[model samples]
Structures are given as structure tokens and as C-alpha cells.
Target chain A: MQKDASLTTPAAIRKLVRAGDYSGHTSGFAPGFVQANLVILPKQYAFDFLQFSQANPKSCPIIATSHSPGVTDMPTVGEDIDIRSDLPRYRIFKNGQMVEEVTDISDVWRDDLVTFLIGCSFSFEEALIAAGLEIRNITEHKNVPMYVTNMPCQSAGMFHANMVVSMRPMKPADAIRAIQVCSRFPSVHGAPVHFGDPAAIGIKNINKPEFGDAVTIKNGEVPVFWACGVTPQIAIANAAPDFCITHSPGHMLITDIPNSRMAAL
Target chain B: MQKDASLTTPAAIRKLVRAGDYSGHTSGFAPGFVQANLVILPKQYAFDFLQFSQANPKSCPIIATSHSPGVTDMPTVGEDIDIRSDLPRYRIFKNGQMVEEVTDISDVWRDDLVTFLIGCSFSFEEALIAAGLEIRNITEHKNVPMYVTNMPCQSAGMFHANMVVSMRPMKPADAIRAIQVCSRFPSVHGAPVHFGDPAAIGIKNINKPEFGDAVTIKNGEVPVFWACGVTPQIAIANAAPDFCITHSPGHMLITDIPNSRMAAL
Candidate 1:
């Protein structure tokens, strides 16, 4: 925890990961900076993936992407980013299946690989906490409960799948406030898509999630669902791109851009 | 309905009301202008009621007040406005009990009366309609169902009572959109206070309401509750002021101010 507190800046955290010193999840590290989900794929599938992101902005809001196919410097999001080594962990997928989990991807770096930085929930979670709302996952010390809903995403070329959502239990009053707070950050999955009955969205059981661990839902609290960053991953896997890479579940690429800069209003 | 279409402007509606030509409810008339709730109290009770409104803004957001006692000219809200006869109808109360209902209060006008213009839900209702969300009350051709909740209002001098909330039935997805739409108009009760189960807010039966007509709650729809303008009236009645006047339930004081002007953002 002390080490976590020491890595306060995005640059410092990226430096630690680049030096092979820190290889853990980047959840609470670099508090105020924006942490993004990484999705690297061969340039052959870049246009279709970009179209899919635009069609489903709520599920996959794109913040920035590789300047050209393998040029690794994302100056728009960070100062000097080495896409292969800046993140703590990376997952390599071959033919729609994860083949290897590695600390760095320098060995498999391809000139035609396109890096995508999609917005993550961590930004809005930080905003919600600052507004004095309790996130159930944070309180229970577990991953936010994620589920694949019957709500389908708009198809783009060959990329198409059902939307994935992450749930957080909140009292109705708090949920109302969360909507207002999240609405300002449209770049990060703006507002919740649904609340109340989980079965209404095709979730048979609230206790059993398909993707992440379930958190406690108190008596009066309702489960509010937001379009998760994981939706694109599911779509990508379903598309069965010949080669692709993504940051591991909780690990993400910390950016120099402040979360406040993402506000729409 | 043709007459309503003719009376499209706020000034025209106020003119008709002032001339004793139109004495009907102002809902759906003068669509874009702000319609306010009227609360006229004697100078002796003005300070306490003002304090009460300030303490509970969500329930009683004050848009304007008379410049001074006996001064009916509210130039800020409109041009040459007469507080006594501008509304379609008025209700007079004596020692907390309703004594009479009339079209014009000029006959009983006093030099000690102070006028208070409060924000009404009509502003946000317009916004919801513009956003393409159906307002159940409007669809059913009934008054919005309102219930007296266990939620307590902050006590101010000689003013204290339980809160009153107006309910609108909507699907969870539409309810989420309503929260965002209403949040922009804080002067008109802002966002919904509670949603889902009525028992959570102390309403025993969803169909039975203490005030206004109940609207239908469809199969997948949930009851969304917002702090109502009636809350102030309830508090004032509970306080039992020596003499007071207010607009009749559906009769509002139409102002020249546009509905968009009420948006906080």
C-alpha cells in the first residue's frame, strides 16, 4: 500500500512498469490521471474495430489510438509512451483465444499493430467517490460484477457481440447522483444503461456474474449497470481476429491526461 | 384544445387569465415558458416561509419574490405583471384551513401581502418530452400521482412538515434518461429523489395517493419520485399561518422567462 502511494504520478508508475519493478494491477495507482484499456490488433482489422467503437460509444469510447500502425508514442494521451512496456501486464490473443500473458510485449511487437486506448470505469469511479457515493466493489474488496447482457451492440463489419455491463449497487438517491456525475464524462461510458431488475436485461441471477466477482447488494440498494470496457474485448474475441493483444483485466495504461479534462460540460 | 393552441405565448395566456376569459389549468398551455407556483403570505409570516424555502430548495425552489410588501409589479419575471389576477385561479386560507376559492384576489387584496414565485415541475416535464420520454401523467390525462413521504423537511421558524413527492411511472431505461434531463433544471425540482419500490419511501400502495390522480405503472416500468412543489404548501398549511393565498392546484402563474433559462448548465 505504501508503494502504491509512492507511485502517485502516471509517468512514475509507467517508469516502474517499464523498469520491470512493478507487475501488479493499476487500480488505485496514479489516482487522478486517466487509466485506459488497451486493445492492439493488426492494422488489417483497425477500420472495422474503430467503426464498432463509434457505433457503441457507451460501451467502447475511444480516447486515442496509435498515430500510425506501430509508432508507439501516444503524445495525445501521454508524454512519451512505449506501448509494449508501459503497462504492467499484457495478454496476447491468437485466433480469438488468449495464448500468453507477459510482462512486456517487446518480442512480439509488429510494425502493423494498431494500439487503441479505450476509456475505463476507473475515471468515473473516482468521480463517484469524490461525490461521496460508496462503490460496492471497493467497499467489499472485489472486482466489479460484470455480465454479458441480452442487449446487443451495433455491428460494425465483422465485429459484433452482445454488450457487457458492470454493476454497482447503490441506493436510488445515490444512483441518481451517479448518473449526473457520469453524464459529464461521456468519453468514459457516460451514464448507466439500466437499473432495477437484472432479469429485465436477461441476467437470470444477480448473484452469479459471467465475467467478474459479485459484490453485496444491500436491502434498499438497486444494481445499476454501466456499459463495461470489457464489451470490446468480448466483441474482438467473437470476431476471431487472427492476432490481437490487450492489457490484463485490472491492469491498464495510465495516461498523462487528467480525468477532469474528459468532462463534456 | 384549439383555444390552447391559440394561447401559445406566456403573455397571451396571462392576458386571457387576467381578463377573466380563461380559467382553466395551465398545463400544456404556453409550452416553452416557465410556469410558477404562487405563495402569497402576509408580511408577518414572510420571513419564516422564505427561510423554509431556502432550507428545502429541492421541494420549494424560489424563482422570484415581490420587491417589497404590497408591490405587485414583478418586472424581473415578466412585463407589468399583476400578482393578484395573473393566475387562472386562487385559493385563500385562514389559519391553515381553506376558506374560499376564487378567480381573482383583487377583491381581498391587502397592503401587507408578499408574493413568492416558486418553480413548478412543468419546466422539467417539457424537457422530458423534448428528450422523447413519455410522462405517464400526461399520457393518461391525469394529475401526476403525489404521495406524502416519511422524508422530513428541515425545520425553519414556524415551518415543518413531511415532504410530498410526485410520481411518474417509467421503464428503467427511460427513468435513467429522465434523471439526466431533470438534473439540468434544478429550479424545477432538479433530479428524481427516489425510484423503484414505493415502500422504501414510505408509500404503502402505488395506486393509492393522498393528492392528485394515480397513473398506471406498466409491467416493466418503475415509479420515479421527484420532490414536489406541493411540499411547501403542506409545510405552510402545517404551520397554520393567520392568512395566506396560493394558486389552485393546476392553476400556475405563467412567466415570460423561457424554460431553457431555468437550466443550471
Candidate 2:
């Protein structure tokens, strides 16, 4: 919680991360701001990966991307969100295997790398909570349950995988309200992809999730599932890109853009 | 289908209805125009009813209201929509008892009357259908099944009733898409209030709807329920005002406003 001005502002948080003082997840650090999933790859695979994101928007909503290879500063999303070090934690991968976890990517930075900032669920979750809908995972203090689904993603070149989804249990009425609230933020997964029967999308057990801790599903509540940011990661790994870098799970690139700025309405 | 120009233009449809040539339900006429639920009340009850609409916006989304008592021509919604004769069918009620249904209300029109144009579901249904989601009621060629819910509406002075909801059957994915599409048209019912178990909303039997014919719920489909336009009528009936009128069910006032005009985005 090194939140000083850093806790309140995106640029300040990046400053702290750049100074090697913090290496933690960015959730709850800056209210009302956009937090993005970071993906970096050599320019060779950038074109195909961009196509994959554009083709499957709900799972991989692109907020901003580097205008050209080797550009480290994303001035559009934030004043100076240096891709090499702004994120507190980075995962380096080689040929699809995660090779190292580091506080900053400055040492691993390459001129041929292109960075992508994909919309994260934090934006929509903020929206739903603001609308007075109780988010079960937030209430239970756990990562929203994420599951791999039978629903396949449209592949682009070598990248291919099934769509992944994050689930939140809500009463039917609250779920409806959540849908309306989330729809406004199209960049942040928009509305849910599915709800009701989990097995319909190939989830076998409700209590256990593949990627995150499970929350209590109260009686009479149905699980609502949204396209998860993890879908692209899985697709990238399956592609076995020779070199890649990404923010560690929950440790996102905080941006100056407000969540409301992404709303369609 | 006296369409031609009249079939496509809302004002032209009003002209036909005014001349006593068309007196049927307005469905499928003026394809992309907005159709409104009509409610007329004496000046004395206007304040209370307006309060009711304000308090319960989801159920009673008031698109426009009479600027002043005795002004029948609503220039805002259309060029020349005469509340007295524009709608194909008008129901005359005295102390909450329906007296007669007629093509023209010119004879019964009162100088003290104020008209309210409420958003109808037709707008969102068009949007959903355009998005390729099946509306079960339309496929079944039946009125949307409506249920009386135990969910109580906020009451205004001399007006009170439990919320009434119209049900639509859709597969969960389609229902989620419907919610997003409908959310853009807040002037209509907006998003569904509930989906999944009917018992949650106090509807004892899903098959036995209180109003409108029941549409079949397929194996994977869930019943998505929206706050209904019928709500105002129930409130009006509870109020039991001495003089009142409403458009006969499905016989709406076709407005010059295009359906696309209602999208909040």
C-alpha cells in the first residue's frame, strides 16, 4: 500500500513501480480509473494478435496499442506509461513458456516489441458496484472465478484457444442490472457472454474454478459469465510466440483514462 | 395494411386513424418508428401520476407529457398527433371501470385532460430482432406473457400498485444480448429486471401468466422479465380517478420519432 499520490493517480503509481518500491497487483489502488491487461510481443506476431483481438472483441477489448514497434511510452492511455517499467510486475515468456517474473522489463526491453493494452474487468466491476449491484467475488474477497469454456475463439494465424470467462454469482434481478451497467463499457468486455447453466458452456463444477478462487453462490442466484482477459493470454501461449511479455495476473497497467470515458452511452 | 406512405410514416398512420380508415393494432406498421402507450388523465391527477412515473422510471418511462392541460396536439412526439383521435383504439374509463372502446375519442375528450406518452417495448424488440435475437412472443404469434410480480412499485399520492412484468423467453446467451440491446433504449423498459426462476419474482406459475398468452420456454431458454408498460394502467386503476383514457392494448400512438432516436448511446 505505497499509495501516496501514487495510490491516487496512475502516473504516480507508475513512478513508484519505476523506482522499484512496489511490485504488487494494482487493484483498488485508483478508484474510477481504467486498469489494462498488458501484452508485449515481437512485431512479427503483432499483426496476427491484433487481428485476434479485433475479431473477438468481448474477450480481448483493445483500449490502446503502440503506434509502432519499439515505442515504449503510450501517451494516448496515459501521459507516460512506459511499457518497460510502468507495470509493477511483468511475466516474460519464450516459446510459450513463462521464463521469468520481474519488477520491471527495462532489462528485457527490445526495440522490436509492440505493446497492447486490453480492457480489464475492473472497469465494468466498478460500474456494476456503482449501480448498487453486489458483486459476489468482491463481497467474498476473492479473485472472480475464471474458467476455460467450450466456446471457441476465432483464431488468427497460429494463435488459437477457447474463450475464457470470469464468473460472478448474482440473483437474477441483480444480474439483469449488471448486464445493463456493463453494456455501457464496451471496451471492458461489454455485457456478459453467458449466464444460467454453467455446463452449457462446459463448466463441470461450480465450487472450483480453473484460474481463481470460488465465491459463495447463495441459493437462488445464477452465475453470470463475462469474456475474460485471460482468453488472449491462453491464445498467445498456444501460438508459442518466440518472445513475449505480459503483466502478471491482477497486476495491470493503470491508465489516466477514467472508466466512464469508455462508456458507449 | 393500408400502408403505402401511411404504412411507413407515423404521421401518415395518424392521418389514416383520424379519418376512421384504420382502427387496428399498430404493430408491424411504420416499421422503424416509435410506438407509444397512451394515458390521459384530468388536470387534477396529473401531478400525482407524474410523481409515480418519476419514482418508478423503469416501469413507467415517460417519453413526453402534455405541456399544459387541454392541449391535445403533441407537437414534440409528432407533427400532428391529436390525442383525441390519433390512436386506433381508445379505452374510456370512469372511476377505473372501462366504459367503451372507440376509434375516436373526440366525443369523450375533456378540456381538462392531460396526455402522457409512455415508452413501449416495440422499440427494444425491434433492436433485439435486428441484432438477430429471437423474440419468442413474436415467433409464437402471441402477446408477450405478462406476470403480476410481488415487487412493489413506489407509490404516488392516490396511485399505487405492485409492479407488473412482461416475460420473454430466450436462451441465456440471447437473453444477455437482449439486455445489452435493450439497455440502449432506456425510454422503453430498458433492461430486464429479472431472468431465470419465476418464483423469485413471486410468479407462482410460469406457464400460467396473469395477462397475455404464454409463450413456450424451450429447454435451454430462461424467462427474461422487463418492467412493463402495463404498470401505469394498474397504478391508474388503483388511483380510480373520475375520468381517464388509455390506448387499447397494442393500439399505440405511432410517433414521428424514429426508433433509433431513442438509443441513449
Best by lDDT: 1
For model 1, how does the per-residue alpha-carbon lDDT over B1-265 read when each residue is reduced to its tens digit?
3565667888888888899988888888887999999999999999999999999999999999998999887999998799999999999999999999999999899999999999999999999999999998999899998999999999899999888999999999999999999999989999999999899999999899999998988899999999999999999899999999999999999999999999998
TM-score of chain A of each: 0.98, 0.98
Clashing pairs in 1: none
Model 2, B1-265: lDDT tens digits are 5467535777777888898988899888888999999999999999999999999988999999989999888989999678898999999999999999999988877789999999999999999999998888999899999999999999999999899999998999889888888888889989889999999989999999999998899888889999999999999999899999999999999998899999987
User: Relative to the unseen true structure, what is the C-alpha lDDT of residue B140 in candidate 1, on a scale of 0 to 100?
Assistant: 88
Clash number by candidate, in order = 0, 0
Instruction: Tell me how candidate 1 scores on lDDT.
Output: 0.94
lDDT of 2 by residue, A1-265 (tens): 6456636978888788888888888889889999999999999999999999999999999999999999899999998677888888999999999999998888888889999999999999999888998888888889999999999999999988899999999888788888888878889999899998999999988787899999898899999999999999999999989999999999999899999999987
Off by over 4 Å in 1: A1-6, B1-6
